[model samples]
Target: MSNPAPAEAPTGAGTAPVPHRDTEEPAFPAAADRSQWRYRPRRAFWRSRVVRAVAVVTVLAICALFILGLVREQTGTEGFLVGLGLAVLPVPLLMAAFRWLDRVEPGPWKNLLFAFAWGAFAAALVAILANSFAVRWIATATADPDSADTLGATVIAPVVEESAKAAAILLLFLFRRKHFGGLVDGVVIAGFTATGFAFTENILYLGNAFGEDQEFGSTGLGSVTAATFFVRVVMSPFAHPLFTVLTGIGFGFAALAPRGKRLRRVLLPLAGLLLAMGLHAAWNGSATFGGPLAFYAVYGALMVPAFGLLTWLAVWSRQRELRTISGELPAYAAAGWLSPAEPTALSSMRARQVARAFAARTYGPAAARAVGEYESFATTLAFLRDRARRGTAGPDFPAREQELLHHLWQRREVASPALTYAARATGRVWAPPQYLDYDGYNPYRR
Candidate 1:
């Protein structure tokens, strides 16, 4: 298809002349004329983002200090050191897996970091205190500490811990709504939160186990420490993440629902929370119900299947996001906002990587960074338009669209040629016949 004709610049007093281009049309108005599209928030000093950020950081810092003190107190110095070392083994792997799933439209690291911190410190503190209080109350009322502990593990712990972890998801959903978009976003955030929770919990379990080993004078593979390591680290590092991801999927579907459908939005997440609690309860009760046989049965029959299904759903949803980008961006392409090949090229991760590599090789790292930013802006634009079409976008849709278009326009000179080259190299789309003649060809000219 032929490129769209450049839009005629509007004539008016005080307007700067639009710069001339030989090959491509400007996507929107000239940068100098976009004052109308800018958004400037007007808030009091106390309500400003900097103030709010400081407040949040302070609260989280306090929570971190308290939780660290509590864990260290219980584990003792030597046991705590051993537990910290062992518990950290699975964190990187889990974080990497969740991050890989988020490659299509990655959210800010700050959001993920906040989720992890919330889980590790705030959520853990809440679960420990609440669960301990409830169990003590139950034991006092029923005069049976053993049954109270059993009830706490099966019923109270699930409710408290899942709710605590879900608090991080809820906060992100309510406040950082932009980043908590779809299934994968929800899954990744929940995974991080749960990973953090598991990290702290593993330290406690492994530390207590080490203490038990010291008490029993055992120092080898057959000791309590080795068993705890095998069970918590190797056998089921994904346990907590699996449970929390159910709740995340619920929130994901809720995010996709229209704003007018309040009941559906609320009910979806509640249902997911209930499912998460049920699964968690079952897993916790497995030993009490039927020992190793029951634990293995639940792991094999329920957890494994659920994990596999969720993994498939997450992968399928990611692929669907790419398809959405390719499908939606062509309209902008036809309107001169993007080159004809970009929609297709941006749809493939391979092409995007190739584009960045080509830019780095041809024009240095800054150009590669520009190309990456262009891809991100383009993806955000596609999602915004899709949300608008579905009647789920917020009131700032027009302003946001303009902003994204401006960013894409700024980087297109460097990004476009690299993407075009990537498209050609990957055989996603061929160069136009007029541009194929090497005698007059200039790939970097746009």
Candidate 2:
């Protein structure tokens, strides 16, 4: 080699291989492109065969209980049918509504289903058993016939019943912190669980209404169902969700808290749970003590404001995420990793949504998915790099992060633009060339 460089091999007829030209890296590496946002779920989650099987059994058991309640009802087929219809009617919309409110990455279907199932099965059974036993025991012990009903109203109903509902949200948090994401997501998950519980519980009451009808005819049942439905579903479908959301908030905090501060994490969640319990108890007390009309006033006066505050907090968190992403991506652009065009496109929520739509139009849903995935990785990398620069991330972290960034960048270029090209070929509108290009030069230039 020292004797004349061993006659250096020729490059493309007197040209050298362009640096960064290996954009399509070996294996569609996860680092080369940061514009894509991957929805790839994390592996080794709590969901497993056992969890699935158990969840299936739990749902079946709930069905069986509902059937038994139906059989005992004097209204027979009509009552059962009505109950079933009512129970299922709001499910899809309710689910969609909650999902819309949730901005953080959604959790697995099974995890959500399980949380709801816990409410329908374990929570329901435990609440009934605990309440009935406690009520009877209170009556016997206190030797006042009114004691059981009094305690049930003042203590047992509020404490045990709400605790049972809160337990569903708690277990979801314990089993799956990554799914918790943040406060908005917490509210959505808890809301669904609460909805499930409310639906099942409604059937019981509806069945009772039907039975009362059997004794008093359709008029009686219709009156009961109408009045109850208007009060429960129409007026305040939010009660259970509001109560359970507190636990969800606690769960969100627990997931977000740093490790090693065990006391702080535990205390925060405890405080949230206490808040949920207090609100739940007060609602139940007001509704029970004041009758339906009084309950209406209390519900409007108190619950509406509380819920409004939660909604505002959710919007605030969303804005914070937008700001965080906006601030972080510019540094990545200055680095060689991202083209100037990309950070602008991704950090703006509107731009991001349009990009996704464009990807989908060009490459179909699959392309859109890849784009989203790449972006998510890019975001994580940006955060990692920032931490490293701040001395928060450890030494050598930047090197490792760069490796990942390279892979994602390559993947983004391939999957992402391929979609754009595909869209053009299919006669779909693609992003304007000027908009897609960067600074009158290709950022991917050598």
Candidate 3:
């Protein structure tokens, strides 16, 4: 028999009263019940307000310095402006692609913002300085500046740049642990970080290329600037993001690793980083082996296949996430916390979109936002329950699960009917029969 939970002592002004057993528990405790009153949350170092403020200030300072350095190094303010404008062209497209991949359980905007900032600012700055120094040192030792530049690009640059980009993923995995769940999340975060890094690097290269064009009196389509833009922008926008995504995938596996598998958790991300660095090195070194034709051959043969494979992997992972939601949320539905058709609706991206649109149409944009929040919370709740079932849940699992349930309950009046309608409208076979009249079922009308 399990031990009874400790009783709380009663209070009075004159004397101590008799203690009474508090024999209560949540309907789904998720794990064995413990005296929750004694469970205080652990305070982490980064949670401190002062630490957070200092970290923000430090990152801002780094970004400022990097921007200033880029402007100074590029020369000719006109070229810098042109490069800045041109470099930004691919960013939104890349971001949209990653965001689409993460639609099943979109991560927090703050995490994505941090990844971008860290890549564009901190990572880029470190790469630039470290690569410059390393290349110079190699030139001095080898006494062949041309060969040194090749070495810098193929060897030093890849390691420096990929490691710098991976730092953003590492930080998120460590600090924003909740949001760094599974493969899609890892790929999305890494892709955004790499995109930002590429954006800054593109500005530098394009600006320098433009400066070279101005030196040679070349203009228009035949110029070095045009070639750089075509190569970096048009031909291979996904180059940097593709390389860094390996590292992110590694971190993703690490995140999904069961607790206590310390070796797997540590080694997987490292292996991913090494693979990223190797791929980046191969891409850089390609040009050295032969002419542009050779580089293109490697690109078509290796890079294209790798990209296609990773894309498939990311899509497959998203499908798996949807299946997990479909499989897990039915328990909550049975518990009456969610509608019978809600799990099926939540699993379909098309249904989710329809639900949000329906919510907006019925009760304005605020209702749509509530519906979106409900979806996120419900998805999270499903994942949490899945984790609990697998015995990998942390101490706060019950609290977090309850919190998500509470959010869903608050928004259910609007979200439920919308989702139910969505399931029916989308022609999902599992859609509950009663939900066909969802419009007439006013849940809030007590």
Candidate 4:
């Protein structure tokens, strides 16, 4: 979805600020007429110092519930160990996958878990309740026509299960709209929710497979179970992510899309959801057919394309920042706040990384980190500029937004012990000498 329009200034407050069009001028924070503001585990609690306490408690409670279930079942040694193994292996991988794709501003760990926990708890509960009845009703109506178990598996699970899982994305939109900055952010959030759902769902499937194996003898089910696991968990873990990302995209569009473009906001995410459902349905259909042709058709026609499209979109979204920097740095350099060579160096992603690494080399680890932060903030500003160009904003209306964002860069630059401030008395050697002069400071004579 698109970004929103710039806020209009009050009648007495002079002209409203216009967000800039496509030129790559660094959006220095112009002014804020107004200011605004996983999963893992049992072990996920320990990943960070701050959240560790709550995470630990949450994990223990989950573990206790599982342990109690085992105790009540009076699971034999083999059964219990099988259940435990089935449960634990996926947890680390699920968490690691979330961590892997979460390169964007690392989001609220609590929110990640909220998505995950919702899937694990609410989705399952609701699916069981709703589908239980639907299955029974359908069976009676059709005299086992729909087959209750099949209905639960095919129909109820996708809708109720997906909606409950997607509720996490909705919650993120409701509470932390700012976090849902763009489509990619939406993708990440969607992805986490999916990961959470898949993690929990896999446990049942995998656990059942194990339980069945013990009760009925292997009968080659280990291979069948492993194959399903590979397809669902390994091949394209994006299945759940794909579904919930639609909600995330909707939320992002709602917060950011231009004033009159609300229709697009509604439509785009719905389209994404439709696409997701189609993929889910196709996969189900193919699996239902259960032959080599079905396998090849599902993988070739549906799964691969979905995976490729999302991958392309993610990369395309990421490249905009680089392109924007390439476009805007000249304007900043002309303003004398950015040096000539520096702008070129920071324009490309590779170059920006090099520049960041260069700062690290010259200044040290702290400077490197500073450069990284500065680049991130700068890249985001460029993205906003692009959004504004597409009429996401009113006009070049957000002069203050530019100024505040620039102020962040300024602080980041200051944090970089290696590189000196650009708009200072001293000048770089290779560039033509320039001077900084504003209302208070004058470097030119009348």
Write one digit per residue (lDDT tens) for candidate 4, span 102-195: 4434456776766666665555555556766788888888888546667666666666666666666776666555456576667667776676
Ranking by lDDT: 1, 3, 2, 4
Q: Which portions of model 1 show Cα errors greater than 4 Å?
A: 1-37, 431-435, 438-446
Q: Cα miss at 228, model 2 (Å)?
A: 0.6
Top candidate by TM-score: 1
Which prediction has the highest lDDT against the true structure?
A: 1
Judged by whole-model lDDT over C-alpha atoms, candidate 4 comes out at 0.56
In candidate 3, what are the lDDT values of residues 1-446, reduced to their tens digit?
Answer: 23222222212111111112122322332332333432345457888646885887687577758665765566568788888899999999999999999999889887887788888888888888898899899999999999899889999999999999999899889878878778998999999999989988888888888888889999999999999999999989999999999999999999888776889999999999999999999998888867798899989999999999999999999999999999888877765677788999999999999999988988999999999999998999777666655545565664565556556767888999888878878888443354343447532332
Per-residue alpha-carbon lDDT of candidate 2 for residues 331-362, written as tens digits (9 for 90 to 100):
55554455545654554455555556666775
Between prediction 2 and prediction 3, which has the larger TM-score?
Answer: 3
* Candidates 1 and 3 compared by lDDT, better number: 1
Overall lDDT per candidate, in order of appearance: 0.86, 0.61, 0.82, 0.56
**Ranking of all predicted structures according to TM-score, beginning with the best and ending with the worst:** 1, 3, 2, 4
Look at candidate 3 and tell me the lDDT of residue 366: 100
RMSD of 2: 9.6
